[model samples]
Target: MRIPTLNHILPALAIFVSGAAFAGDLKIDVSVPADRQGLVMAAVFDKADGFPRGTPLRTATAKPVQGKATLQFTDLPKGDYAVTAFLDENSNTRLDANLFGIPTELYGFSRNARNMAGPPPFAEAAFRMEDNAQQQAFELK
Candidate 1:
């Protein structure tokens, strides 16, 4: 008898499966510019809904260095997730905005998907993560 690795099973079962998904923290390390540095609040959303609200959620914040920061998400349910973060120089948890709700600070989303006119759609931000554990590194633009 042989035991199959998760890599083989995951695809066979589909990209996602009910009652089976990775749980726990997914560590992310980000390398960013020194000119824009501050506390980075990462919003980890399962979908567009329940965002900036409700209790079922995942979030992480990093104390920025001049050039880099490491973020660790705790107890994140394995599934589709989008990570959006901003350089909060003002120590505010919310995005700093201009007159028209346009952001004044450096911001980013997963996959680095940017919209021509505004924010990317939720589908664009979505990334499928496996259960158990994972680690990733992203270089900010």
Candidate 2:
């Protein structure tokens, strides 16, 4: 049998490699209160510089139902990531804060990280995304 040429083999190899590259999914479950209504927003960060602030590497939003909500980030590559979420009660698409910069709306982080003097650092919320689907839970406070 004649062997296939590079032109024929390269395309198939590329497709195989590309498919393997995106073999992970990050699923987040947010526990919202039944009385609260609005949107559940989340942010994913690959670095600590602007973690829990600024723009994130990825973002997701979902509406709560029966005191629960879920957000899924699919086709993610293996790497370190941190997540932060908030309950947008006003539907303004942004977390509200008081005059002292303290959040007035409910918020949460991956691993259930809590703020002491300030928001939890990336190290506290960061998680590794391997070659499998992973799930994380957060509770609004």
Candidate 3:
């Protein structure tokens, strides 16, 4: 029988330790208009490729009450992340946009970043997540 040497085991141990140390949780607080009634939809992205329109790494929904809604994404690896959210008042599972490509629904992004033409770029809204709980807040526009 052969026993593994220290060199062989060190690399494997480092990977395991690093990965385990980086798992974290993110809590999102969204403020909606008190008169609005619908689901607060959110999506989390790790990259800029799809951004506001692309498929997200994770998605969640929370019903608003008293002008506030909260959602949590747990066990995420340490990295850069951006969030986009909207108040789906009509419950169509999508943001309502007007003829000029302007959104009619209340919406927001991480860092509260906004652009005159469209959604803010990923870099503008990206945040670093570490091995601890983090909180982000947004208000519907």
The Cα error of candidate 2 at residue 96, in Å, is: 0.7
Q: Mark the regions of model 1 whose C-alpha exceeds 4 Å error after superposition.
A: 1-21, 50-56, 139-141
- The TM-score that candidate 3 achieves is 0.86
Q: What is candidate 3's lDDT per residue for 1-141, written digit by digit as tens?
A: 999999999999999987786658999999999998889999999999999899999999999889989999988888899999999988799999999988999999999989888899999999999758999998989
- Model 1 vs. true fold: TM: 0.72
- For candidate 1, what is the lDDT? 0.72
Cα lDDT, model 2, residue 61:
96
- Give the runs in model 3 whose Cα sits over 4 Å from its true position: 1-15, 18-21
For residues 1-141, write the lDDT of model 2, one tens digit per residue.
Answer: 999999999999999998787758899999998998989999999889998888898999999989999999988887889999999999898999999999999999999988788899999999888867999898988
> On TM-score, who's better, 1 or 2?
2
Give the better candidate number (2 or 3) by TM-score: 2
lDDT at residue 138 of model 2 (Cα atoms): 85
| Every model's TM-score | 0.72, 0.91, 0.86
